[model samples]
Target: MSVTVIRPADRAAWLDARRQDVTASVAAAVLNVHPYTSQYQLWAEKTGRLSPDGEATDAMMRGVYIEPVGVAMLRDQKPEWAVEYHADNAYYRDEKIRIGATPDAFAVDPGREGRGNVQIKSASESAFKDYWIDPDTKQVIPPTWIALQAITEARLTGCDWACVALVVITWRGTLRLYVIDIPLIERHWVAIKTGVAEFWRVVDAGEHPPIDWEKDGSTVLDVYRDSYTDVRDLSDDAALDVIIRRYKEAKELESSGKKLADTLKPQIIFALGNSAAGKTASYDIRASTQIRASYVASESQSRVLRIKPRRDHDVDASRF
Candidate 1:
């Protein structure tokens, strides 16, 4: 497939281009490998139900800020590999798949056959430990999402190979750099297309992807950002009942004084309104908001009872 190269006039145009296509950054989300983005969120963005411009997270900002340093390392390590960093912002796209990627650089290795895609990334020490390292084997590996991003770049640019130039900043404030080549793009192409095709099919059908209950908590809240003030009884929803039961259990754990979760008890109680008490075997859990002299409820309401995947920090060994 012939790839279209577009050097946008400005950042707005670059972002506008991304709105229509499933850009490489979030490509792995469709396959459920992206750590941050969920499949439903990607569907929402592509279908125009949600804004495509997601806020630049700290991790994302660090990647942009430290990319040059990683590229500098890439130059230092492989002097023979001729690489060009596009400062003007060139987007390589394949219209057939409606997929595109703007890689950090394009390279031509004197040792290799053809041009290669270079993806410069910056990860925190913990992220490097978690995603890029095979724990038991201790072998360095590019993350699935990162690999997919590079593959999309290679496919669009007609590159024979893709490379991830990574820089990791440790908690102790040291930098680590590595050059990882993503081999066998042709082998992965079919799987990528399959996932992407199914994603677009759901989007075209105006249907949400299956709810990834563990990862889509924040996404669920965001989907109802502009929800009406009118109350609707969801008593018939069996799924909601299960989710609510799980939420109550989490709240119970929080109230148990295990100290793993912070005090969101008041907030949960306030969300429940007049009836905000539940009894367990050990104790009675009750929540009531104090009224101030000038009493007025805020127009905006906070969504409670979100289910999220537990992070390493959120886990407590003592409880076990």
Candidate 2:
């Protein structure tokens, strides 16, 4: 595949290169499945709106420092693999897509008898424990997001495989290579290409990807912290109206459920006086008291709901 190359002289140049095109590292974000990065962040980065400063977290620095060690380890395992680092940004563009990839190492004439791209990663002990694999038993458990990243790079470089090398550092300062394997999943490559093209279309149209409140909570909090200074009441937006109506209905249901539970609780508790729990044909119920410290009162006693075995029961339409 023909690609445009941009050689970055330093970190600043590298950051600038990233702004010019979507890189393999951010492919998962474009797919809306990246653990740390949200779709909004990826859009901002690709659109040149996000600042490069403060982009490097402590873990990122650890990865940068440990990458060379990882490369050395990978070389030790496969002495015949010719590994070379690329300081230039590799970008491929066409009518529907503009993508970039900067591989950590490119292996040529490897012992595996195939050329491939190598990506090095460093993760915390907790995170590292998740990447363990067994070549003997053929058990491979890898992080999906990072695996997608390597696959995206392979797609861009026209390589059939990607070697993923990871350095896992423990809290006690121990380091280990938890996994080193070439993952060449065809389905991942196809999904990545399709998702990137979709993201590019969104960029071309000057629109943002839909925010996922559940997944984007941290990013939203960071961006809106002590902000929203020029806030104005929104007019009757139909989309927002749907959300608001659903929210209202949910709250009403919650209130009614709570009221019905309150009405049922005292009667059930009276029947099972001094007994901790009771079971019926339809349900198993338990009552427990909890004492919690509150600001208004030194200590407050509250009933704890402990219900289980929620079997199916017919609803009475006449009651409704």
Candidate 3:
């Protein structure tokens, strides 16, 4: 099959025709890239499954939630070449080299005289950071990998330039865009092509190839795993106890039930009350339920129960 060269006008029309479908396709492609796939696959393996499909699978739910959110965030950034939803480009070699990349959205800067093909990416904040920073050196990884992917798509369509636009949507719904230039992209094309060749070699040898990121000086899996482990380790029982108490208190408030403030562990109580009152009184009141009451007698001889409430719940009430 002859390679279909998509001109800027044609590309624009094609994207306008099928935007949503193309965006989903792009999101799926990104998910297949190094760190994303590795993390998901590891999660699946840990849960004793090859695929995240079951309704009960947390992995499946997480993937489902993230992809659409990422896509929406990308669309919201509204790149100049936002193509039709689901625009698909297929390139086939008559003998063998049949591979395709369906970019979520493709745009060209009319102001730049349609010089480059821009690929738009909507990513979770974590994924966005992982793509940039080198896992080993903690430096910014060259944008070559991104540029290479864009170039491959450009080559498939016989375009001269490739641009990658990444819109990172943070958990708080903030969007940030990163653009890749053509010179940087061209510099990395040869390495990406060589990496692809090595991948084919591994396939022919009946072995899965190690990811290019490992050789590219960064691995998403290592970074994600290391960060995850660090967080997990820091959340020890003592740390978690504080969180649990807070959660319980919040839940009780939501339900309008009597707050089980007393059931909160001593450590949490001490932390909450350490600022107010003397430590001795706070400790004495927390250690036992013996209410410390200060009495005031008016000139008329009426007694007032001056109860010192727990630090967090300072409800001052007088019983006559």
Give the per-residue lDDT digits (tens) of candidate 1, residues 4-99: 888899878988877777888888987788988888878766766553465678866777779788888888989998988866678878788888
lDDT of each: 0.68, 0.62, 0.40
Q: Model 2, 41: alpha-carbon shift in Å?
A: 2.5
- Candidate 1, lDDT over the whole model: 0.68
What does the lDDT come to for candidate 3? Answer: 0.40
Candidate 1, superposed: residue stretches over 4 Å from native: 51-55, 229-320
For model 2, how does the per-residue alpha-carbon lDDT over 1-320 read when each residue is reduced to its tens digit? 46665667777777776666667777887777777787777775667553236567886777777878987887787677787765344444332367777777788754455578788887777765555544566565666787887887776777767868777778999777754565787887778778888887888899878765555433433332221113122232333323333333444578665444343444444333334555443344455555688888566444443544426643222422
Of 1 and 2, the candidate ahead on TM-score is 1
State the lDDT of candidate 3 residue by residue for 1-320, as single tens digits: 24433323454554433321212122222234443434223222323323222233664455434444444554556455443334344221212232344543445555555445556655677876777667888754435445555666665555556555555678897767656555535544454444444444544465442333223112222221111111112122344334344435554586553344322332232232222212222121222222234557322211111122336532222310
Residue 260 CA error for candidate 1 (Å)? 14
- Compared with the true structure, the alpha-carbon lDDT of candidate 2 equals 0.62
